[model samples]
Structures are given as structure tokens and as C-alpha cells.
Target: MTITIDTTRCIGCGMCAYAAPQVFRVVGKYSTVISQPEGRRDPKVSNAENGCPVNAISVTR
Candidate 1:
């Protein structure tokens, strides 16, 4: 799986980082993916994507 965040849609809410610190971080006014998805399934990552108010997160496999 791969994770991507659309900066334009992001509100920098930090929920991604809160839900999956290993994969995301809030830098400045945007959420960033700190690492690539290493073919691992993470419930927290899924929760983060679902939790985005603007639906900025994307997961592809």
C-alpha cells in the first residue's frame, strides 16, 4: 500500500500524525507523509485517512 496526502485539501489538523505517527507528520500548515507504506496494513493509517476532514489522504495498493 501507498499513502499520499493532498496538501491543497489538507487543513493541517494533525490527525494523521496523531493516528499514525510512523507514517505522517504535521509540518507548518500541512500534513506530510514521512515514510512510504512498506507493504504493511495499519489500522491507524486507515483511521487517519478516514479521519481527515477534507479527505486529503489517499491509500493505493
Candidate 2:
């Protein structure tokens, strides 16, 4: 599975960064993808998805 970030929907709130710092982080005022990349097994991906208030993030297999 992989987590995708909809840049258009992202408001740059930085909430995703705070909830799952290991998988998500903030860069230049916008949320960014960290070390864990697409198709990589991750433990906190679900937490990151839930943290997004606008539902800007999701995981797919």
C-alpha cells in the first residue's frame, strides 16, 4: 500500500506532520512525504490519513 497526498486539497495546515512525523512532515509550509515511500510497509500511515482534517490523504494497495 501507499499513501498519496492531494496537493490541490492540502491546505498546508501541518497537522499531518504533527500526527505522523515519521511518515509525514512539513516543508516550506506544506506537508511533505518523508522516508517511507510508495509501496513501502509503514506502521503510521493510517494515523496520518486520520490526522488530515480535509481528508487530503489516503492509502491504497
Candidate 3:
């Protein structure tokens, strides 16, 4: 899986981090990818992408 965050659209609400702490983090008013998972098998990653209020998170496999 590939994860990407559009910083311009990110609101820093931390929902991505809250949903997938291992993959995302809120930093300086934007959500960022902290680590890349091997694939989309991790459910939290999907939750993070879906939970982002601003649709800043993107996951592609």
C-alpha cells in the first residue's frame, strides 16, 4: 500500500493519527506519514484514510 497526505488540505485534527498511530501523525498543523506499511492489509490505515475529515489522506494499492 502507498499512503499520501495532501498537506494543503489537512486540517491537523489528528483523526488520521488517532485512527492509525503507527502510520500517521499530526505535526505543525498538518498530518504526515510517519511510516509506510508493507501493504493495505492493515485495517487501521484504511480507517485513517476514511476518517480524515478533510480527505487529506490517500491510500493506493
Q: Candidate 3: deviation at residue 14, Å?
A: 0.3
Instruction: Please give the TM-score that candidate 3 achieves against the real structure.
Output: 0.92
Q: lDDT of candidate 3 vs native?
A: 0.87
Each prediction's total of clashing residue pairs, residues at least 3 apart in sequence or on different chains, is 0, 0, 0
**Winner by TM-score between candidate 2 and candidate 1:** 1
TM-score pick, better of 2 and 3: 3
lDDT of 2 at 38: 60
lDDT value, residue 16 of candidate 3: 85
Worst 10 residues of 3 by lDDT: 39-48
Per-residue lDDT tens digits of candidate 1, residues 1-61?
A: 9899999899999989999999999999999999986767789999998999999999987
For 6-49, candidate 3 gives per-residue lDDT tens digits of 98899999988888899888889898899999944689998888
- Model 3, residue pairs in steric clash: none
TM-score each candidate: 0.92, 0.73, 0.92
Question: What ranking of all candidate models by lDDT puts the best one first?
Answer: 1, 3, 2
Q: lDDT of each model, Cα atoms only?
A: 0.92, 0.76, 0.87
